[model samples]
Target chain A: MKVKLAKNYGFCFGVRRAIKLAESKPNGITLGPLIHNAKEIERLKENFNVVVNENIQEIPKDSEVIIRTHGIPKQDLELLKQKTKNITDATCPFVTKPQEICEKMSAEGYQIIIFGDEKHPEVKGVMSYCKNTPLVIEDLMALKNSKIQEKVALISQTTKNIESFLQIVDFLVRNCAECRVFNTICNATFDNQESARNLAKEVDIMIIVGGKNSSNTKQLYNISKEYCKDCYLIEDYLELRKSWFDGKKLCGVSAGASTPNWIIDKVVQDIEKL
Target chain B: MKVKLAKNYGFCFGVRRAIKLAESKPNGITLGPLIHNAKEIERLKENFNVVVNENIQEIPKDSEVIIRTHGIPKQDLELLKQKTKNITDATCPFVTKPQEICEKMSAEGYQIIIFGDEKHPEVKGVMSYCKNTPLVIEDLMALKNSKIQEKVALISQTTKNIESFLQIVDFLVRNCAECRVFNTICNATFDNQESARNLAKEVDIMIIVGGKNSSNTKQLYNISKEYCKDCYLIEDYLELRKSWFDGKKLCGVSAGASTPNWIIDKVVQDIEKL
Candidate 1:
């Protein structure tokens, strides 16, 4: 089987920036996994001596702590401020934009509507900034059913699709008397998904490598699966099945933002041997 | 045939207020017809000696000018200010609310979407307040097709139906990221339409009495027609067809904001004879 790599794959700008920040603070403890990918986090822990801990209170006082790319909720950030004097903020600026926007709009008496997965850490971080309970909608149908106020402001998580975001914007403009919309879908997620979709169209089987918990990786897999029927999401070469490559004429490879290049190369070399 | 009059009909609050204001300055020249109904305008001209002039330039300098219920464009209002020192602002406060809202929202960099007839005087007046060109959408389809902005504000002509207005509001809230809406549908129009709709449901035939040019009157006729198929819109008893009452068990009579109570009574009495 012939294998083709997606044009834009592997670590995105924000992810690279975050990993670099974590590497610089060699002895630091990240508030969460430095990134979503377990393999990448393990490498950081082993090579840079960086520890991963979810709870702020568990970390020793005055020790260096790094905020992850997904960002932390306001309460957690406040706790971190009090607990740690040596702080390394690696929160993606793209994620920071929506958080700031939600805070400003909610203060101005606008009912906030968020178009993002509610359970996602990035979405949770952004939602904490709003003064009132925001109507968190993951799909167009939920947005259609949401109760409206006289004034509303809408924003989205960094990893959401642009088309769905614009669709929600269009619906709100036609329904609300006055609306404010911000297109906060980060460029890296958009490009990666687009590249994966494009590659999937020409391949008989598609392989998307990333952590199962990574939002952008799951999105890439979902997008690729739409164009290619035989699509698989695996974290490393160990999970890859030889049966997937059987009788497949062409295969496409793509990786999520948190996926390290070394893991992708190993997966590619193993697929070539099959 | 049995004739039943709508409980709430004829001479709406805004129209009554405007007429009362015109009556106080009996000798002044109204910028336009003080109200939509021609018969009422003629009565005001003949009895109160108030003349109706469409052109601001035609009126003599320093002459008393009534602004009328529908209000005037901003430029005309400016002209009136310069040309005449004695100006009576008879513009309905309900109509004025939308105008002020459009101006304020447009100033705050919001695209204004008005749910109203584009050619309507009230809509025109509201549009004049906006610095940028406002999107005047009359129906749900037109509103759905309108291009959206990051921020949007919606207002309505005072005579628009509350149902359609709310539907538009719901659609906008679902689509726009941020939206601001003001239900500027005047109370008089809402009550009149509701009364007409209620009366039409009980009657076999309906008579809507008002000038053809009156927006609220047309709305009442449309609303009554939906519930009663044999609905007829007439200015007076002269236009009421006797054939409409043929084999009809009951007849309903309703009037618009500009329709005089005397006209409604005459139409009711004429229908009773039929």
Candidate 2:
């Protein structure tokens, strides 16, 4: 059986920059674990003395604080900067756009309606950018709690489903007299989804490659599962259970952004052996 | 021609909440336009006194501050609260999930990765929730900038395409050693998209009902367009030109969440007339 791997899959620019930054300096402390994969963290730990800083205050004074690719909150960044002059900011440019939008919408006095997962770190960071106590809701009833008005500024978390974002936007537009929406979902994000959808259509057994803790990876698993019943998630060659691919002839491989090219190669090689 | 409407069509809960809040009392002040719809905003102006407060300092103290279904950044909200005590929040619950994720990630020392349009209000709100500087990416570059090992969290701005969100997630898991993620897309959102996809398959002409400024409506238009070339977006009966009836037999109508029932009814009537 041949293994087909997605060409555009793996760690993105921001993630690369972050990893390079971590590897650039032998001495650095990560706020927590960097990325979602366990194997990668172990590798990084061997090269650099990376420690998870749970308490901001507990961080060594003037320690080289490298903001992860996902980025720390604005306040945290400010605090890091204040504490240490040496701060490496690896925040993605796309992420910064949401901050600017919140500042603009909140300043305009529009009821800031953010459509996103309330528990995700990215959502939390975007929330800090607001100028007012922006009301947030996931469903219809919760949306009702927000004061209805002619002016509502709508936005989505960068990773939100575009279709879902539109539904939320539609809801706000229908109920509110005036709704201003900015399509904040990343362009690459959308393309990745489109590609996955297209790929899923052609595959019999889909294998999503990513860390279990990775949000995007989990979403990939879920999406592939919807189309391909044999879809399953595994981190690397080690996790590839031979049992799942009993007599599987065709397997489509797709990896999360954080995934390294080396790992993708390894997975393909392992699948070929199977 | 006979017209059939979608079961889950029309103004969603968030839109209704925002509109109701705007039109509510004898005294009301919106931070900006209630929604993006021009007609609806015009209607709101007729019924209520809508005001835009762009300059944070310009807001009068003790004013009744109303939050739109589109959320604001956390910092802006704090600044607004500092100026006024009374706030009417009208936001959807699904939208708030990203905020929670940001907060949790920040507290736990994970970097926050947001997937959505960075410029959108929803993304902004999620950033604020983190109270930290987050890396917001709309594309695969986000994976490069995500958390490493022990500290990365991923989330989507609600209203995002589930397919898109999953691709980004998949990237994270494959590369990142340790990451946490949440599939925050609302249930109603998926249902709407699925319905549209299904309808597009069986209809000769599909009519999308909602405001031009509505994102979900546009998405619906895009979906229908993919399957049927004759998909039309109508804010109300006014936009439904007679050309739409060129040789259509069965027409499918789907409204956005923010579209009022009246608007859908008017469109339905117009289709019937056609």
Candidate 3:
């Protein structure tokens, strides 16, 4: 069996920068997982004594507080400022862009439309920047259910699919008299998904590596599944089955932005043995 | 021979208000023909001394200045303010709405889209209110060539056809990311077109009465011609040919908003004699 790797697989600039920041400060408490990959986060915890805590109250007063890659809400940032002087913001600049856009547009009295899953932490953080509650829609059809305002500005989360964002834009343009759109999908997410899609078509079996809870990893897995039927999303080499690769001639490997190089290399080495 | 009239025939609320305002002040020189009906304007000139002046510079200082129903630009209003102390603004409130929207939306950094003929007095007046040059497209196809902005606000001239306006709106909603649309079509135009459309199906010949230069009158004539082959647009009864009604079993008469009650009555009476 031949094992091929996607061009843009593994840790993105944002994730790498975040991990480096986390590693620089030993005994630091991250608000959440610094990066979505569990294995890399585990390595960080083992080597650097950095711990992930969902609640800020659990953090010790003297301990260094590191904001995660997804960034915290304005209210949380304010609380963090008052709680500790030792703070390292590992928040990705790509995620910070949409927050500023939402805040500026909302303050200008424009109704803000965000095209992203409301449950996602990045989307929640962006929405928190808006002074008023923005219309957060996951699907295009959901727009019909909301009361459309006369003046609107639209922005997307960093990891949102570009095609879906364009579809939403098309719908808004025809429905509203005036529409303003901002393409906020970061270069990392765009390149990763594009690379996975291109690689998926040339291979018989595809493997997507990252944390199961990671949204971007799930997106990569779904995109690969669109072109190749034998696509599996796994956290580690332990989840790999020998029987699935029995008849496959060419196998493709892709890792999410949060997934480290070590896990991807291990997965590829195991696929090569098949 | 049978003569029929559209349910909502002539002299709309705005036109009636303008005429009432014109009649209250005799010997008043209007900036333009008090309204778009030539015969009614002639009567105002002959009976009320309300002469139409193409240039405001011709008006005597301290003389009462009457602004037309299709309003003047901000610069002209200021010039008029400086020229005369006694001024009666006959600008229709419906026409004033779009101007205000253009001003406010442009001030808030939204690109304004006006759906109307660029050269038309009402559209020109509305366009003048925008701080930046607005995208004034006459048809849906014109929109395809223009660059669509993400944040937009759309308004229409009071007399634009609702169907064409909605088609333009449909295109905008699908093409723009965030669009803000305001339906600025006045009630008079809606009722007039609907009434004319209903009346045309039953008539053998259609007569659309108003000034030749009137945009709403041209729209009425166009709409009536679609349903009736023998539709004629006339400024007065002198332009009406008796031979056109020779074989017609039923005749329908509709007048534009600027057309007076007297012209419609005379046209209906002439058709009755056929």
TM-score of each: 0.68, 0.51, 0.65
Better of 2 and 3 by lDDT: 3
lDDT of 3 by residue, A2-108 (tens): 99999987788889899999999998999988888788888989999998998987777767999999988899988888889999999898899889989999999
Q: lDDT tens digits, residues B1-274, model 3?
A: 6888899867888889998899888998888777888889889878888888878788888888888899888888888888898999899999988999999999998889999989888888899999999999998999989998877888888888877877776677555544566777787887999899999999999999988888888889988898999999987777888889887898899999999888877877777876
lDDT of 3: 0.86
Cα lDDT tens digits for candidate 1, B76-132: 899889997899898998888888998898998888999988898888888999999
RMSD of each: 6.7, 15.8, 7.0
For model 2, report DockQ: 0.03
Task: List model 1 lDDT by residue over A1-274, tens digit each.
Answer: 6789999998988889999999999989998887899998999989999989988889899989999999889999898889878998899998998999999999998899999999988899999999999999998899888898867888888888766776776567556655666667787887898899899999999999999999889999889999999999999999999888888988999999999999999999989888
Candidate 1 residue B272 Cα shift, in angstroms, is 3.4
State the lDDT at A61 in candidate 3. Answer: 77
User: Candidates 1 and 3: which is better by lDDT?
Assistant: 1
For residue B251, model 2's alpha carbon misses the true position, in angstroms, by 20
For all candidates, state DockQ relative to the true structure. 0.17, 0.03, 0.13
List where candidate 1 sits over 4 angstroms from the true fold.
Answer: A1-52, A61-71, A82-98, A109-274, B3-8, B140-147, B166-177, B194-202
Better by TM-score, candidate 3 or 2: 3
Worst 10 residues of 2 chain A by lDDT: A169-178
Residue B183's C-alpha lDDT in candidate 3?
Answer: 70
Off by over 4 Å in 2: A137-149, B1-274
